[model samples]
Target: MQLKSLRMLEAVCDTGSFGAAAQLLHTVQSNVTAHVKKLEEETGAQLLERASPVHPTPAGRLLLEHARHMLRTHDLALAQLQGLDPQGASQVAGTLRIGSMETTAALRLPVLLAQLRRQHPGIDLELEAQPTAALLEALMAGRIDCAFVNGAAPHSGLQSWPVFREELVLVSGQPLTRFPTPQEFCASVFLAFRQGCSYRQRVELLMASQGVTAVRIMELGMLDTILGCVAAGMGYALLSRALVEAQQQRFGVHWISLPPGLAEEFAWVDTCFVTGSVAGWSPALRAFAQLLGIHAQAIAAGEHVRPGPAQRVHRRQAEPMPA
Candidate 1:
């Protein structure tokens, strides 16, 4: 079958319908149907289940895995060849898909992205905000080119660079005079992002450290929502000090430092930029990584890294307490 046919098959599976795939591929439904039929005829096996929302049959799923590899190889080859042209060296152009944790996306990426746009106008950037676990999965599945995740790469196939450091704090509506006892902590609800969030995992660990075996956790999707709930005294949340302080005034929330041992063990975290093997990186990805490297270096040197406009706070109504 032709590469175009494989592409059509992949699109159909991705969009779950012939018409939707046509829309995504910028083609007519008839063309998509013809291409899919051609692939099935060539392979002598049914590829898709003709349902309302179509699904790939077992045979189709196997072919789709190979199709993605072929497509990625073709795209990477084109990008590399373009990069070799001396005339185009200054203007690296490609779509760079990035995945990041919501907190990082909110607090860290704005300045970096602004710099990237000014330096490389040809690069098209797409950013997706998810939890660290989701971002890692997206990176491995090829849905995203790189990710700003919680820690170093956990899988052997991936590589990572430490890009940012975060100090975690316990947030609440009321000021904390001292560390809460296990009984007190158990009586409170913990608000966090959905199950896959790294911060959510830290909340559990923090509770366990307090000798609390069972605790209640409320899963919320947005950072603002979690903060708002905390401000309303609905629950407590564990978040980065930078992130919480950025919106403390608006949310009327307070935060306290964790005990030194707990902070060292669970509260201090490195947000890493992770990607597949170096061989798979596109020029756009390389450029972004270089910028992050420079930022990391500046941070290491104890220079003041300015926050982007979105992160800047004009005034703070509350300050973090030492617990």
Candidate 2:
């Protein structure tokens, strides 16, 4: 059938009623009905169940699935063809949906997105903050165009590359001359994000490695809230050192690096950019990937990278620790 027919079919499936679909597609109900009817006649299969909120038949569901892929391909082609800059880079002019962890968004994306916005004024950037696991779920479901996730290994149907290596630190409200033992640390309440948070998961694993089990956890949704609780001596939290350091002045939290062995293994978390295979190579995504690649490469080459607002505060160069 025609592309317009597939668009009508998709709108119907999404909106769940002929009238709603017609309104959404900016056409009359008769046109929507006609398109679906034409598709059914051409395919010789019943397409939809005539329900209140219309349900797709098995055949309709199959076509609708392919319709989504085809539409994505069609839109991507148009964007790529029309949105190129004179400098040979993709002029990102459409919406770019990005999912990220709050920490990564806070520490890493600000500068990157600022530069992008300046370079491509036409791009409309959309951001959603979630735990890495949640971000991955959204990416897989096509809800987000790409995600900035915490350390992960390769997986099927997705591609990921390192953006930065971030140091995870144990944070507390008060400055400590001596760090607690693993058992002692586990006894303290853990302030963290919800269950799916990668930093929280790493904390659990690190504690478990020391035979610390049945630890108490407090689910604090916002980073500022969690840090506030920590400043009140509520509990300890595992977070990017950069994040804690950035707010150390406000929160008066102290950070401690992990011991050598565990630090070598779990202390450093890789922030990665992930996308599904289909959208991974989109020009908008490619531009972002190139930026990250250049940054990572510069760091790897041991160049003296100037610190930005979102930069990792190097532990070796001490800032005055908050009392």
Candidate 3:
């Protein structure tokens, strides 16, 4: 069938909603529904199972996989053709769909995006923020061009570039004088993002290492919500020090440095830029990677990213004591 129909099918499957697929495609809901229905009629099989959030049927899934392959091939062909341009200055213009973790979106991407826009005025950027695993899935499925996420770069059919290392801090509503003992730590509820969040996973490991048997976990969906809950003394959260410091005034939470042992073990997470080689390299993607390299170089040169005034004020509120 037509490539447009296949593209619509893949979008609907990825979004799990026809309406969302339409939004993604910059079309209307009825058009997305009609495209899928036409495909079903032509194939003589039902493709999607109707539900609140629809799911692809077995037949639909098979088509979706093929659709991904075809679309990736098409994108690669376009990228290669563009790369062949003798005039290199015009090669960097295209749509770049990027996925990211909420933490990175909140703390790091605004400046980078602004710079990108200024440098490549012809490029169009679309961003979606999700947990690391979800972003990886989107990248693999050709839903997004690339993703910025935490932890070691995933090895399967993907390439990764180390963007930066994030220093994590444990934050609480009440002031914590010393690092909490395992029992004390596990006593309070742990507020965190849903499953697959690297920060949540790391905190769990930290507690387990300290001989903690169990912990209470509250899964909050958004970063700001977690911060609000932690600041209200509802629970504690683990977040990038940069994020916590940036919003310190709004949340009024205290950041606790871990004991040297724990700090040494769980203090940082590497943020990596990941993309699938199967989809080939778009000029937009290459440009973004190049921009990341410039920043990574500065970090490698031992340049300290100075803390903002709010973070400086918070640090001065108490003498620096080892957790």
Best by TM-score: 1
Q: Candidate 2, clashing residue pairs?
A: none
Q: Model 1 misses residue 95 by how many Å?
A: 0.8
Per-model TM-score on C-alpha atoms: 0.68, 0.66, 0.66
Candidate 1 vs candidate 3: the lDDT winner is: 1
Model 3 segments beyond 4 Å from truth?
Answer: 1-91, 299-323
Score each candidate by Cα lDDT: 0.83, 0.79, 0.80
Which portions of model 2 show Cα errors greater than 4 Å? 1-82, 85-90, 278-280, 299-323
The 10-residue segment of model 1 with minimum total lDDT is: 314-323
RMSD of each: 15.5, 13.6, 17.1
Please give, for residues 1-323, the per-residue lDDT of candidate 2 as tens digits: 78899999999989889999999989999999999999999999998998988989999999999988898778766766566653446576667899999988887789888888887777688999999889999988889988988754246788666567678888998886666787777668889999789988988888887777777789998999999999999999999887888889988899888877677666876677777774445666666666667766665467342332223433233222111
Model 1 per-residue lDDT tens digits across residues 257-290: 8876676677777787888977767888888888
